[model samples]
Target chain A: MCRPLCWTYASGVLAVLAARTDDTNPLSGLVVADRPEPDVPEGWRLVRVKAAALNHHDLWSLRGVGLRSDELPRILGMDAAGVDEDGNPVVVHAVIADPDAGRGDEVNDPRRSLLSERYDGTFAEHLVVPARNLLPKPDALDDVEAACLPTAWLTAYRMLLRSGARPGDTILVQGAGGGVSTAAIVLAGAMGFRVWVATRDAERGRRAANLGADAVFDRGERLPERVDAVLDSVGAATWGHSLRAVRPGGTVVVCGATSGDPSPVELNRIFYQQIRIVGVTMGSRDELAGLLAFCAARNIRPVIDRVLPLHQAIEGFAALEAGDVFGKIVFTIP
Target chain B: MCRPLCWTYASGVLAVLAARTDDTNPLSGLVVADRPEPDVPEGWRLVRVKAAALNHHDLWSLRGVGLRSDELPRILGMDAAGVDEDGNPVVVHAVIADPDAGRGDEVNDPRRSLLSERYDGTFAEHLVVPARNLLPKPDALDDVEAACLPTAWLTAYRMLLRSGARPGDTILVQGAGGGVSTAAIVLAGAMGFRVWVATRDAERGRRAANLGADAVFDRGERLPERVDAVLDSVGAATWGHSLRAVRPGGTVVVCGATSGDPSPVELNRIFYQQIRIVGVTMGSRDELAGLLAFCAARNIRPVIDRVLPLHQAIEGFAALEAGDVFGKIVFTIP
Candidate 1:
């Protein structure tokens, strides 16, 4: 039988079946039971989740983020690809911001919150999201491929396209083997950009080349020529290198700092060379739609390192924590 | 006769002088002597300076910036408005970069260097600059008014227009009393943007309002609403407030750091809100030309706090160092 509530904890606790009333480790507690699967709430639709992918954010949530111990039994997971009750396969964009909340651009609204923060998110057997967040999954892609896109893939798409880069531009992707970096390399290569990869590990560099990077280099290795833009997520360690690798008037887009934050900003280089540093989060629903269409039209498939049954999610999380995966680790549900 | 070389040094040492033969202190070493006036080089024009502006940068040059004790006998000033050899009034653009030195956009060239750093600057009674750097001064404006541009005015123009701001946008000008902030307030006001000024002194706040700012606030005070962009030259101390004052997806354009360079960056706000931080330098020749045309067409007179004779330049520098002037302090040649 499909489990109702999914509970997660930091100390090797994995997603498990639970009763609606039972709550231990209240912060990580969640009751996703079969208490009348969510019905369409006006503009929202009930998606019977066929698959949902895991992100680092999901793990961060389990460790208690933006959720108090009193707000127990909160649904977790941000990326979902599933079938609506009408039996149509669709992908759910994870960012759950209201369109009417801001003056001009909805993305500019400060009150906006993503799924799993203020709202119950995916990972449930049945998930209901705003109709606008639902993009039809391509007939060519299976549920697993569609599930891996809403967070990591959407972030990579916006970072490359919306950050003022054009085709035939040269882009440096810092940290080669992660989900966003991998996606950026493939997307930039497809867009006809000369994509260079920087990585500390030689194995990751080789993998980046295999994933269609034009060239690969060690983390701080000098390039033959400066690039037009740099996609930097490895924060403190690669910040200086990102500044040095771009040409004058170039841009560096930063999404997350997995290594650390608080890097020494080289103000002299920034002003003297007229450099731009742009910060991006996951994209909007409109951008997510565009990304899905672009991927479907271009036959671009997300790189999936492994997929495991929902019951075996602990193994997947362990693999992720061990840093043994090159791409996304997904969880499949019935 | 104007001194070909002038010299000054710590502890009664003779320093700078300008002469046909290289002197140890070109600005301070040699006495005034009769020498042949400079002729315009090819693609250049000789400007017989009627008025020259003393910038803080000029003071820094006297203290040695990109200059050695060996190359002491050098010309100083970067801002000047004078008459050409043909007796046409002109304003000299100080940045002397080779237009054809780099690939694609000449402005993006790394090899470009400013006047005082490389070639002779505007301090002497007469100086030669590239012909393109000369903009015709309107007969309506006097030499002192025209001389206040080139560096500070051009920089402010580019920071407002070219730094990702549209008309009708709202911006926060951090540090309301400085050269760039004062210029930004006037320019942004004329261009139809709502401008807010932030400063430590309440008196400076009133002064900023008189300069055409819509509102003024105490430093680091929470704004009623987040602005579309922020103009930040005061780093470290005001960096946090600058970042906080802009809405999500807004921009922060930085040119200098009177406070300090490195600051504690709030990386969470940056990434989650998708803010853009752009570093700007002095404007290009084309930009300077646009600024000249804009001011001339609009009849905008630069704010001049005081004027001093060229011989009393030390007093001008002293006033600038005291930071009490409301606007630019210009030095006029007799």
Candidate 2:
């Protein structure tokens, strides 16, 4: 049992903890606390966190979706860019699974869990993770940019890079301004894919175009032509468009359906045209390494919406919950 | 114009033609008639009919769904096995497209059409097809068995084989009685996959088990454990079970939604667990050739529900339309 580890900083650590879980108002449980540092577990290393990105996942945890109240009074950040005790700057791969049991793919392991789900995550001044989860941070990206790569960026990597898309193929990214959508836009462009974006917000569409999108469309606008693939994160709102925009034998890769699942499954259209709908989550450590190398090689930097002091993480969560931010909201652990 | 090419026996040809199209009463248009024999076009050869399989496509043609009234009175068989001009047994490939135009996949060719779409189809006395579309029928399968391979069998092949299933992977086929479902049961067993079937009809379930299904369940019955992949064709009725039956990272492969598309696309479960929904159409000629070779080598034969004489073609179609047949229905031409 978690015995009120807050306000009694035995080993001197400050963290953004979930004091309680409130599904109706997720942020109601937000608390900044001073807690004892986590002991380095077997085969794990303690990392001094430099930056941690705030994802919708943090809010979900606060809402007790993946995090339980018994596990509450727990820390809440999943993506972190930090320096290990060895003083090497690194990015953390959040998935924790035994590689040998999963044929070298931790994502396929059924019992796998991510940080902030079953353990105290990286919101603290120092956090512990399996040593294998650490990858050298690219020099081209700072700590906050590297912080965004683990969850949202890696998910987009697995969805786009592994969707069997070649360099010259055209892919459509549905929903602009969201972390995964914008990340896909940048990654697709850098990887030589012809990228397009759709959004209700014209300002976000213009920003996506400036990020190298070939074209931008109003939400539900007609595509110039059918594309080879579509990346959808906005669920009910854009799912129909994602299904309709791909060419015959093309694919629709999904990571999150944030808007919620839409009605009328569109089975006839899927079968008649021969489309593929692939679901992706956070990628493997090997993939994360590749993403780092690719970012370093291509000089790609993740887009950051805003960064706030660790003690002021509530402002970050409030911005994310309000849905006013364009990209990732990172917390600087001070 | 079709010009009512019906009974008069003017040119000594026997065929099942769509005399008219009626949405409410499709069978009224289905007519077994005597018409002018097919003339061999350039680069095409006359294949003296031996056996032709009855499929839902013919019923659809009669219902004005792909075949229009202007295209009515057109002969309507899609899968045929017969002797070519050289007097060698051959199975006709129904799809017609330039492989070079679609990266060696005609299914990707935007304007590609299947037999009975733009040209006269296989249900006729000495139907003619492009020489390239003919693959020598295997010695192992008789005319009736070979006739079932092109449409139902080939579509099942594409769905299961291309669904990325490895030998010994557990896959659940949702329906039990349809041509594709039975074909999947046999093919998956032959390929070393652990196959299961779910059927509402107890007799069909017993038949499916006899065809080598590892296990059988009542329609929508709870599975013992989630499987690696699910094959769905009974759309609205089984779509929910399909989504629920697959493990995280498992796939839901579909070829046809015979039951109509269902509502509430289940976006939450899909994104949360990372499931794949793949849509498959008919197989390619190369894939068909491989299937034929596999069947011949494996000593596998298509299961026939019944075989009727060419003049009694209506009985075969009626059985198919009524959904009373558990396997393929073939019509033999004397």
Candidate 3:
């Protein structure tokens, strides 16, 4: 449908783009195409991306949740690990915001935007970002594993830190096998928390146990004992259960609402039981740096579901949209 | 309906009691009658009540919200100041709970009950409580003012302490003239916070100003700027406003839902903005002590609307039910 000029590597670089959009079928708009290499603005650096990971954000972008119709052909990715022009390996911190605007915590910035929302993203063989966006990737992790740390893993790490649960405390993670939830299970175990997973899928529960959850429960099942905090990404489907699963004066830390928001939230139960509901998004740049150091120090490796060549990014998106991934899906750039 | 035998001072003490329940007309069950003076159990001390304060809890008790039918004729009061057996002037810590059960914070105990809920309360000539429940009343405060601190003032103090807002930061107190809200206005100012009040009544707004509120807004009005935290006890009527009034990463501290619980809680807004919703009941014994010391040191006085003889307790309940109060209503014992 295009002149060959659009695909010529001499003038463009290979990348995945959300060329169009479909609310019901997000994959329809996904395109494996070519895009001009990003320019390095002043105070920015160009990175040759060695690997990238797919996330729910990509599918949501295709469905126009955060992307606009006019922004079609935008590169589609948020997590990447690569070599900078100076040859240092780095992982990009996806959030783009002025640290001062958020009073030193960039996540609180009102004008904050993710990589793919307002600018070219990391899906391409070459990408440009403000120089401050890069954190040194630990030598212990390969490109694929480092690529998994920026978005989901960083979010999961921050959730646990915000949960206010000390070591030896118990936490209930609602929803299993999702990127953030799975990361929380593994990271919480490493952080010395007693991790409990609740999922409707028995297979996913088993997989979560394999990743080090101390206990697993059927979704909405009453816990054997109340936890000190709960991490809920399942939202409407698991909100009530999360509320009831925590002890009085306990906390429920929420990061996402994948199942939709619950109606008629039980404010009575929230106040009567003296519960706390804390929300988190992706962590700050300093937190991401801390995550990388912690993982390297602890010898933690990200769970990779599968890796595909960059040209096969469409298959990766399909698997993610179909809810078929148990861990991160990586695209290795050739 | 009682014989003269029930009225003898030697046989019984004069008290306000909930003899029955009527949900729609709560005042119907309120009875000014005679009840036997409480017997001191082991480890319990009896106090001759000099003053007691009225709260919405008294009305709710009359409606049988906490008092069961089998517990009818229950004495109804939670806040009291009086002379203990040792002739020491003391204030009762209304929360009757074992510190061991809640890891030293009695408010977190599942079996915790307020004075009027599980035991005969202070709207009588004498009351009994665990010996540990007494704290010395500051000589600077009279019996009436000390009586106002335990139930509502302590709750407001704890709510502000838990709000996570630092001194010089702004806080919005929703529903301005209720006991907790009024106490928050006065205490927040003394605690060095910029207190903004939201109220439906303009008169209450002006009165809040006289009590040290830095600013006032009509209920649900858009704030000039988002606050660092919001104190919300209005619940359904003000929940949405409370959510919107705070900045991202800010807190909304809740203690009661006097206007009924909000429906369709905005979980999406909560998570997306990284807001924190904290629920609080009454404070702990230690926190109550801290509140007393702070109020004394800061020269903070509870705003008293009126002081009436204990025999006029029914009139006080009627005023509370009719929403005709600006501050605390204290009943002095004969």
Candidate 4:
């Protein structure tokens, strides 16, 4: 899956840029440009990009959160798989945190930042990352599939494994068709959880069944039985239903709030029912490794909505921004 | 602590009753009465309650939330230390659940209810509870302190232990002077957590320091450092502060919503900083047993603000209603 770095970057390097922010028109800031190669910091390795996946985080960055106009001309992609300088096939761990600070889990570090937040991201032909962030890419998953795992899949993985969920329990994934929701459906099903999904779109709810969800409900549709946990990423749009879906003493795990803040924290319901609300980030390297093994063992392939050549990546971003993409959109560098 | 069952209820049992519900004036519902003794049902034991403690739950019952006009004349205390029919000193675990349903944890049982919710409670000369609800009281804590444990102190205990708080962590107890807050300060300190407190009253802040809080801050005052967890019972008044006080990956353990529900669940902070909000109700029988042993072993007696005779319980309830009481208020039966 390794692509020659210099072929695409004839003069310098080709990268997708969120050059500035316009909250009303986030895509207006995006620029495809040829730029100087990023200087590798000490203890960091330069990887020749093979493939990368898009995330809603990129959209958030373009909206001036996590990425700012001051940090202009920033490349935007957190999940990537490529060949390191040493020629080892590897996946880049996007989070930059002192491992010691997080007690061996980088995601828990207070000062943690993801790729493109403070550093150049994987949209380029070559990218620099902490050497320690490299994980041996599994043989089972191709570069594009491996690229999708670091951000969305890893987040969903943590929501299941680290969010205190046990096997043989039913879990409600808040959205039916987003990257994390689709990943969670497959991962949770493979891991023996009875997966249920909620969606406002009837079509998406039906499509969710093909992704291995045991049951699908219309958004806010009351269920006959309470679930043991809920994996929520679609914030304000689904928080109340997420809280209501779980059983007494069950957990509601949150990784993202795409729809913004929810109304009424529902303190009364929380304490009365003894619900546990856990906030999850991307994941730990150890968990990423476990996810890799888990996926390989179960033959769990992440759902890919579409694939595009790196030069056509802007279309992928536009499709994602329009919410037209169901699963992940991966860009393969020529 | 072994009181004779027939002594107090010689004719009819003396009890405090929520005779009716008045939202505007909650205390108007409370009445001193000589009511018929509750017959011990199958798998239940009759207890001659030697000491009973008050909680805001009693106030809520009178406010027509937990109790209704149909369940009028219901005894209202959830905490009691008494002598069972076998004459063994015991404390009542107020939660009523079918042990089989919760997988050995009664608090997790969906059908679980507190004593006063659907049955006669411990504010009487005699009360009946399931046999499993009795835990032999340790001699170290007398009837008054032991009675305080099953509801407030055990709630604090569970909030600390079951809420994912670790030892050697700093826990901020919101509100310096409530029964649960004071209990949290004492228990968290004895359990090796650095205890911080937030309160508006200067006198209560000083009093909290005396209760083993390592530091005290005015309510909503910005702290120099984030805490590992926050014990929140103050609800809306301190919800934002509690969310702000905990570090990323830290917890806000909620057991009550006295002030009201927090508006706009801070979903951005919850997901962005990865904050956990764990809800804790009164603990399980096993946890109550551990709390009993822990308090006895540590010589940690609950702070009682005042003790009133059963006949003068109205005055005690008034002090609680006014929020003038700093610690637990217990009623001793003659």
Best by lDDT: 3
Clashes of 1: 23
Output the lDDT of residue A332, model 4.
Answer: 90
Please give, for residues B182-210, the per-residue lDDT of candidate 3 as tens digits. 99999999989999999999999999999
State the DockQ, from 0 to 1, for candidate 1.
Answer: 0.62
Residue A299 deviation, candidate 4, in Å? 1.6
Per-candidate DockQ values are 0.62, 0.70, 0.71, 0.72
Runs of candidate 3 exceeding 4 Å displacement: A1-10, A20-22, B1-10
Clashing pairs in 4: none
Off by over 4 Å in 4: A1-10, B1-10
- CA lDDT, every prediction? 0.75, 0.86, 0.89, 0.88
Report the lDDT tens digits of candidate 3 across residue range A195-220: 99999999999999999999999999
Write candidate 1's Cα lDDT for B1-334 as tens digits: 1233443433331212233322233233323222235567799888888787766565456546455666545556788898988899999988777677534435567877666566666766778888888889877679998898888788788888755777898989998766778888888888888999999988888989999999999999999998989998778778889888888888889887766666555666687788898888877888888888888888888878889876666566567656677778887876
Candidate numbers sorted by DockQ from highest down: 4, 3, 2, 1
Lowest lDDT sum, 10 consecutive residues, model 4 chain A, at A1-10
lDDT of 1: 0.75
Task: Tell me candidate 4's interface RMSD.
Answer: 1.0
lDDT, residue A78, model 1? 83
For candidate 4, what's the RMSD?
4.2
TM-score of 4: 0.95
Q: In terms of TM-score, which candidate is stronger, 2 or 3? A: 3
TM-score of 1: 0.89
Ordered by TM-score, highest first, the candidates read: 4, 3, 2, 1
